[model samples]
Target: MAESENGATQPQQPQQAPKMNVLAQFVRDLSFENILSQKGAGGDVQPDVQVQVNLDAKKRSVENQYEVVLKLKVDSKSKSNGAQLFLLELDYVGVFNIENVPEDQLHPFLLIECPRMLFPFARRIVSDMSRDGGFPPLNLEMIDFLALYRAEIQRRQAATQAEASNAPTQ
Candidate 1:
């Protein structure tokens, strides 16, 4: 309420909070190989596992829709002999309907928030695949998506700077 020349009540518009919904989620591709079984090597050996993650997001044809893909690669090896034990690669896709987010914040939201939403399912798939393949269930640790996003941005900026410096003095 405000007093103009004559006192009158004014209606204030409310700001809408950012909204996001998962329209669909699916596994685009999955591969699991139990190398130890294939090689007939069985013993009480310690496992060394390595994991890599990549993320990509793009706008969809439908209004306010976006598709985000999370790619994961896991490799396990025997700690003693360094022999390969198992390999797992998975590509997960999520379709989201998002609204009311500012343009500058959309990229991070898509990469960080969307993947965070999909990670639990992806992790479960990995655990099941590993267990089904004969070894113990491989429970993946929680990933810090915000840190990953920031590191990627820093890497790109560094690459751009290096390219500019090596531009043959143009």
Candidate 2:
């Protein structure tokens, strides 16, 4: 107990723990193309696959709720002759109810944590889509959302600085 001006003892209040819950998750859009089948190319070929990921988050009309979308693009090409093999695009969305998080930290929490929760489902969809599209099952590597967020912040800072430098003096 700390001494006050009147030497009165006071009890300290405990802080509330942060809360997060996924209200729903679904695929907003999906597309797959079997290029090798379309081209009728039949031959043994080594496959080189590339994956890209993007994220978006927005506040919902309801309080303490947000929508996050994870966009993924997968492309496969023949290593031997660089012929297109297949392509897949997916937009997975999740609705989250979050509370007790600080306002300053909510943006990062949504972009990083919410998508992390939804990635396994998205990965499975990609695998199934590739197999169904007449190609081998494609398993995607885990993403580093924290690194991505840091890089995006740096990019935005650089762009803002460049714009400030390029602005004409009045």
Among all candidates shown, the one with the greatest lDDT: 1
- lDDT (10s digit) by residue, model 1, range 78-149: 998899999999999999999999999999999999999999999999999999999999999999999999
Q: How far does residue 27 in candidate 2 sit from its true spot (Å)? A: 0.7
- For each candidate, give its TM-score against the true structure: 0.92, 0.92
Q: What TM-score does model 2 achieve against the real structure?
A: 0.92
In the predicted model 1, the residue pairs found to clash are none
lDDT of 2 by residue, 1-170 (tens): 55678989776666688899999999999999889989888767789999999999999999999999999999899998899999899999999999999999999999889999999999999999999988778889999999989999999999999999999999
What lDDT does candidate 1 reach at residue 79? 92
Candidate 2, residue 53: the lDDT equals 90
